[model samples]
Target: MPAPVPTPAPVPRQRDTSPAEGGPGTGSLYGQASLTLLVIEDDPAGGLTVPEILDVDGHRIRLRSARNLTEATRLLTPDVNCVLLDLALPHGATGSGSGSGSSDPVDPLAALRQVLRIAPRHAVLVLTSEEDAERAAEAVRVGAQDFLFRDELDGRLLSRAIRYAVERKRADIAQYKLAESKLRAQENARLERGLLPHPLLEGSDLRFAARYRPGRSRALLGGDFYDTVRTPDGTVHAMIGDVCGHGPDEAALGVELRIAWRALTLAGLCGDDLLATLQEVLEVERPNEEIFATLCTVDIAPDGRRAGLCLAGHPAPLISRPGRPARLLPYEDSGPALGLLPRARWPRRQVELGGSWSLMLYTDGLIEGRIGKGKERLGQDGMVEMINRHLDSGLSGEGLLEASVTEARRLNGGELTDDVAVVLLSRSEA
Candidate 1:
C-alpha cells in the first residue's frame, strides 16, 4: 500500500485590526494604523499560496481574498490599504479596458488597469511568474507601486514590499499637491501684475516714480490704488485713493475706481464733478452701504509751475522745494469720503507748485503705522519730518521712496499690517 500523504497545515485566521480594538499595527511604513491586504485572483484550485505576513512591529497583517473583479469591487473599502493583483486572471465576460479611451480584449493587463481605475487611492502590487519580468515592469510603469513574482514571494518580502508601495504612493500624492500649489501662485502673480496701473505720462517733462505695498499677507494687490496720465492738452493728471477695507473685494473696487477716474479725467471732468460721479459708483458697486473711499487728485499745468489740488477726506500731498523743508499742502477744505455723504462736494484749490520741486502723494497706511511699541502713530507731522531728513541726506526719486517705505516698516518693528501706496512726481527747471 502507498504511504499515507501528510495532512496539510490549516491556514491561520486573520485577527481584527480595527481602530476600535486599540487601532491598527504600528509597522515601519504605517504611521499609526495597521495594514490590510486585498488579494484579487480567480484561483479556485489554490494555485497561488500567500504565506502569513507580519508588519515591522510583529503585528499580523490582515488579509482579504476576492475571486474576480466583481468580488474585488465589493471588498475595496477605505480600510483596505494595499491590493495584490494576479496578472493571469481573465478579463471577465464584460471585457472592460483601461479607462484610456479604448478597450482591447487581447490585452493581458486589462484587468490590472480596471483595478487601478476603481481603486485609485490605494497602493497596488501585481503578481506574475518569474519569466514574465517584462510584463511586471510594464505594470509598474502603468501605475502599480511594484510587482512581485509568485515563486519568489515570501512572508518577509511581501510585508516589506507592501509598506514601501504605500509610502511611495503617499509621496507621489504630496509631490503632486505641491506642484499644483506653486502653479496656482504663479498664475495669481501674473494676474495681479497685469491689474497694476501703467502710468501714461508720454510727452511730459515731469519724472514719475511710485512705490506700492499691500498689507494682506502674501497679497500682491490691496484696496489702495493710484494712476498718473498726461491728457491730450499736455496737463498731467495724478490721483491716489484708498478703499475702507483691505480685502480682495476692496482691491477690486479700488481698481474699478482707478479706471473710472482715468476715464473721467481724460474726458475733462475735474474737482467736484469727478468726485461726485465716483461717489455714485461706490454706492452702486460697494457690497454694503458702509464702504467708503478717500481720494486726492492733482492736475499739473503744462508749464509745470502750478497745479490744481482736491481732497476727499484724504491726506494732503507733501511739497518740497529746492532749499526748503517738505510741507503738506493746505487740507482745511477737504470733504467727506465717497459713500460716506450723499451729494458731497470736494473743493479744488489752486496751488503754486514752484519750479524745480517734488510732490509726494500717499495713502494713510504710511502714516498710520505705530511709531514704536506704544500706541502713538507716525502721523503726517512725523512723515514730513522723515522726508525732510531723507532729503537732507541727498535721497531723491526712487531711492527716496524706497528709503521712506523701508524706514516705515522698520519703525513698525516688522512688516506693516496695512496696505501702503505712494506716488512721487518731480520736475526740475532745465
Candidate 2:
C-alpha cells in the first residue's frame, strides 16, 4: 500500500511520557510516548489489533503507524524503541537495496531481519495471527524480544509483553558477562597452583618464607613457581623457577617440572642430574619447544649456614649478612635455562655463611621490575640495594618477604606486572 500522502507540516508528535522509561513527565496526556511505539503493518489505515498493553513503567503507549516495511524502515529512530512487526509478509523483502520498492512483497522472517537491520539497536515484538507458540519462539530466537498474537493482544496484555521483552534482553546480556568472568577465574586458579606449592618442611629446622604474585593484573598466576623440601639428612632444599611464557600451558608445564623436581630431590637427586631429568619432563609436558624454565636452587647444609648453590639460566642468589648489606652470590659457572641446552651442566657452587646470615632465592620477577615508566629495570644490583635498605630495619622470615614484595611494588610505582616468587632462608647461631 502506498504511504498516506505526507501531511505537509504534520505536527511532530509529542513523545510518550510514561512513568516506566522516565520520559519528560507522567503520562497525563493522550498520545504521549511514555511507551513510544512504532507498528509496521500492511494496512493503509493506522490501527493496532493489540487490545490492551502497558509499558515497563505502567504507562500506556502512543502508537505510530508505518505501512509495510518500507515506511517502517524510514520511521525507525531512537524515540521509537519498541517495534511491533506484522509477520504475514512474504520472504526476502526489506524496503532498502536495489529494486526493493513496494512492488516486491517481503517474507515475514526476512522482513524481520531487514527491519532489525534498519533499526539494529531497537527491541522488537513480533505479531502473528494465531497463538502459534513455535512460530513465536522462532521470532524471539530471530531477535524479536517477544511475540504476540493478533487475537489475544489487548492494550493491557500487549503493554506488559513489550515491557517484559525489553527487560529479558537486558537480563540475558548480564548473565552472559557473569558466566564469562567465572570461566576466566577458574582457568587462572588452575595455572596458579602449579606455579606455587605449600612447601614440604617436615624434618628441617630451617624456617621457609616465600611469596608469589602474578604479574598479570586480575590474573591468578603467570609462569613462576617455587618449592621447598627437606631431605632425610635434615638438609633443606629450595628453588624458584620461571618458564618463558605467561600462558596456562607454560604454567601447567612449570607445575609438572616443580613436582618432578620435588620427587627427584626426595629420591637423592640434586644439581645437574635433577635438572637434566626435569628437561625430559619438560619435553614431554610442554606444548612446544620454545618454552623453557630459568631456575635458582639452594641446598642448606645439615647445620644450616653452608649451602650448595646452582643457577640454571636464572639470576644468582642474594646473601645478606647480619648487620651488613646484601649482595648477589657468585655466578661464575652458571648454565643456560633448563629445556634449552640438552647437555647443559648447572655446576654447583658451595658457599659458607656465618651464623645469622640470610639467603634469598627469587625469580627474575623481582630483579626485572621496571624502575620507572622508562625501560630502566631494577636489575640484580638495584634489587640488592633495595634489600639492604629493607634489612637495615631488621625484618626476617615472612616479615622479610613481605617487606621485599612491598618494596618491589613500591619501586615499580604500582603492582609489578610480572610473576614474582621469592623464598628466603635464614640461619641463626644454634
User: TM-scores, in order shown?
Assistant: 0.82, 0.65
Candidate 2 has a TM-score of 0.65
* Stretches of candidate 2 exceeding 4 Å from the true structure: 1-160, 172-195
* Model 2 lDDT-worst window of ten: 2-11
Give the C-alpha miss distance for residue 216 in model 2, angstroms. Answer: 3.2
Candidate 1 versus truth, CA RMSD in Å, comes to 5.2
lDDT of 1 by residue, 173-227 (tens): 7788899989989998888779889999999999999999999998879999999
For model 2, how does the per-residue alpha-carbon lDDT over 281-391 read when each residue is reduced to its tens digit? 887888988888898888888887788988888988888876678988889989888889777788999998777778888988888878777889899888888788778
lDDT of each: 0.84, 0.74
Q: What's the lDDT for candidate 1?
A: 0.84
